[model samples]
Target: MASTTQTKSNSGVEKHADINWDELGFDLVPADYMYVTKCGKEENFTNGNIIPYANIAISPFAGILNYGQGLLESLKAYRRDDGRVLLFRPEQNAQRMQIGAERLCMPSPSIEHFVEAVKQTVLANKHWVPPPGKGSLYVRPLLIGSGPVLSLVTAPEISFLIHACPVGNYHKGPINLLVEDKTHRATPGGTGDIKTITNYSPVYKAIAQAKARGFSDVLFLDAVTKKYIEEVSSCNIFIVKGNVISTPAICGTILPGITRKSIIEIALGFGYQVEERVIPLKDLFDVDEVFCTGTAVVVSPVASITYGDKRVEYKTGAETVSKKLYDMLTGIQTGRIEDKMGWTVEID
Candidate 1:
């Protein structure tokens, strides 16, 4: 068994799991506990349990197993230098999950219930949170159609679950992207704007191809136009040109990322013009910098993008917009800077 050590935290004396903080990465280092709740179709979630983390069994014909009726959200808990744990805009994540649950036909948890459950899970696994600046504890909440239903319909039962893991940066440094002309991520009026589980796996092949070709991820275009940039495989995309910042609008195709929304606000606060519109592919060649935003990557500067025979490189380093935003965002997240926006929830 791995050793454990006691530490004085905001949640009182807690036993921390023995692990190497310096070698943390964006992989699952399973925390000790998880949160789970259940509801019938059209019912509201009320009661939940904090259980030890382990494998779960489900029916073979369950809705999530057969018809892809599931939604998920990702948020992080940061350990401050003062031993306090903070969660960044978890209410936004709760709202997003509620929206996605409606689309996926699963019973949604109330925002209060959802946020409370997340807090319980994080506190239960408080020992897993890395030290300040070492990494963070990644909290993932999932809503799934747990009841068995062979027909193509909503399951009779729904489950809301939350789990956590300690992780580092999703991307180590500046990343290169391959613009995928084919295999669109979502169509008009689809579940792209939400965090549905079905929205992810279809792009695995494209991302795999990009990784095989020495690229970090694949950048997809709008399904309807095929010429306008939509998003990276897992995050939202943005470009900087002159004094304006442009990103694809959340027009039922791109996920409205929490980090992306936060960055837009920060940019406007810094006196930069921000535009949410359809960004054309050719515009990448003229941009000064490019970056992606999501819960995992946070803010990642794009080193270059390859489309067909042409490759366009963008600006990266300390002087770029992404770096400045990253510093401010992380500073607020880790308590290095004051959270003037009141975006963080202090876990006691």
Candidate 2:
């Protein structure tokens, strides 16, 4: 638990909310404000406004509701000991959302527009940022087709909004995975690489089944061949053998994770040979370490993986590559270590 502080809001009102930062989980704890903007089919994104957090009104025939035409991004704001807030590679998320919007035939906010909206949202909810090393304010940016449409067609209007919540680790500890063979998350010619809401909802059943069997998450295989390792349900997978680290290549079937890309560069800086190729399920049995990386999970070690009736376990208590990477990444995030990579953006 961290001490409560009374902070003034944008409206000049003092807010004194007691928050248990250390006990925060990956749940949505509504903040004080959110940023919202909208655009028509031929118009660029307009200036956004910071509004009180509340439910939004939309038409029932909106493309987002009728056809699931939307994209979302997840990033975080970290509170440093010096009372500075930092955003971890927000431009990357902006670019990814642009790509997702293009894939869904929807217009997207420019990188500058997107980043500015996020900054405004975080600033409005600055008091909700957890204490340094305790947790972070999880920022979610969403773009949806807001125009009402009856036939299957591109949306005529779109809206973008940014909201945040204080969150801890998505998974509690080292997690166990179940290899999925029946349910496919994505395919070669599908919207797998994009962060669309439609891409996520279809996998709910598979994940529910995996959790029902007492596993932490589901590890998906390639949809077509079903022989190569693709990724976990929500994160990218990597395995370390000896001094080498390998992960599945981003070939339209895997979402390019910002944390995954950072870890690869960090590992290379540490003189570890990094390989991006097709990893087979059999390779996991011989790997010394396994882990998953994403915005929500950060870096989580995989304790064991069960494929069918056979289960393979790895070492994951303390001294491991995953732990080392997690420490380095979190250190850079919280300003405890020098950010030589220039990945963090400081917010005023």
Candidate 3:
């Protein structure tokens, strides 16, 4: 195995004490069980497992290792007030993984299969799902090539599996991002558009450099112009000016975040102007507000953004518009508000 990690548990099943979401920085809680499946030869997928959310098992010959062929998806399971668990628009994640699989010449899992896998996990481990506002289970679905081959060409054998963790938000404090104009996350015409493991290697240096310089994360710029803001290390960036909300348009280079789409639609539904257009890093300095969206942090504020030596700051909390959106989004997720869009699917 590349890195043998033992689960911090007994019987290989995680038996966590009722988690303290507030102390964990989690506004939500994690569910207990997880669903998984595997792909074998002959375009066949054998029955997977419904394992407890504790440890992971993988083969040393898993295609993700020697050749770097894999994709992953992340989503949350919200626990509603009526003692029900719901999932957001998980179809998008499945569709995205299908796209990634096709591009890598691997087999794709059926949407039905994907959704059922998720449902099984949430239903079995419903107790792990923290309260609506505390935190929720972080579901991760992984697809990797598993054929026993050492060739250089694309292989037909692959495996699709799912795992979960009771992670709180990535961080609770305000986020400070270092803008690395010279360090690019993904090159144009590269696998930047796909959620492949290979896309992460080139940005390790930029991440390390930013951490050493007192920044919590790195913001990548365009490889060519270096003026347009692409994305933060783990999330998509946003700009708010007065009543208008603007985000970087999708150009097949950055991760198409489900949370980003939800926030944009929510803004529009609130009668605010929302624009998905090309945004420059310079525009953020003059904007009324700045935020980042992802499955982890949901609606995290940008306290300060730093370029080579220049820095800009912002203010946001429960009173600001940023906080309003955060509350509304999380409220809808946790069942505080009515889910008019039918974005949530009850798991229990």
Candidate 4:
């Protein structure tokens, strides 16, 4: 790996030392450049530009610091065998961020501007994209209220920025989940469906406690009923039974994951019956297989789940539905398989 001091010019690509792709974890390995743009109350987004990856100065009393007026999106850039870079469903992420901004009363980039900024950032740091079959360059786009404010109100100015990092799996190996009976991830009339910054920090304590108890992740239930499964702390959950696959419905309580949507479409294409409905906590005990989907952890198999006194375990490893979905999804992403769904956008 190269030192962080290694930089790239906007007009030319710089080749850094080879990274140990297989050994890559989900840590942030900084790239050479980032995209930044800003907007005010009276103006749309200005033409963005690429700059060296560094921190920005913000006011101590910024609205993002006080009112939690921020949103984020996560997508990945993949390297194919032929040395081309591909982005998977970035438009979906852009659209989701737009909706999140609307809900949070923050300004966001348009879909075209968001996609272009992502592409520019990826291209500027194309050398950081991992090799095929190894990992990907994780792209994170953030929108925050940068202007200072004392009272509880939306900031007049907003900042949109993007950064890329070479990364691997978010959760390693088969995972064990702890069902959270106490903490609630989202309520019915709250900011549950959006990727707002405030929605994540509230669940840190629950996730930390679960990890301390030797669980891989915490599973959250609905705030009102507590009997129906909503989602995991960071990803969406699904269960398989024979030829049928089902996941909890996106009923304004769970974040609509891009990978979850892709998996549902791909499963339906394979003639598997797919259903999106409320999944009672009791249903997990009788499921044949269980898994999770997200941007960071593409697909992860669930080995066991602990809910109160009842502990349910499932079979994981090769030849499972999760394995198939992972293979198909990654294949399409890396260009090993035909992309019939038009989900991938290749960079020139």
Winner by TM-score: 1
lDDT of 3 by residue, 222-260 (tens): 888888998987788888888998888888777888889
Could you give candidate 2's per-residue lDDT for residues 4-62 as a string of tens digits? 46765433544434787768898778887899989996678988899989999999999
Quantify all predictions' global Cα lDDT against the true fold.
0.91, 0.89, 0.76, 0.89
> By TM-score, how accurate is candidate 4?
0.95
How do the predictions measure up, each by TM-score? 0.98, 0.96, 0.88, 0.95
lDDT of 4 at 8: 49
Q: Is candidate 1 or candidate 4 better by lDDT?
A: 1
Worst 10 residues of 3 by lDDT: 1-10
- Clash pairs for candidate 1: none
Expressed as tens digits, the lDDT of each residue in 191-261 for candidate 1 is: 88999989999999999998999999999998887989999988999999978999999899999999999
The better-scoring model by TM-score among 1 and 4 is 1
RMSD of 4: 2.7
Clashing pairs in 4: none
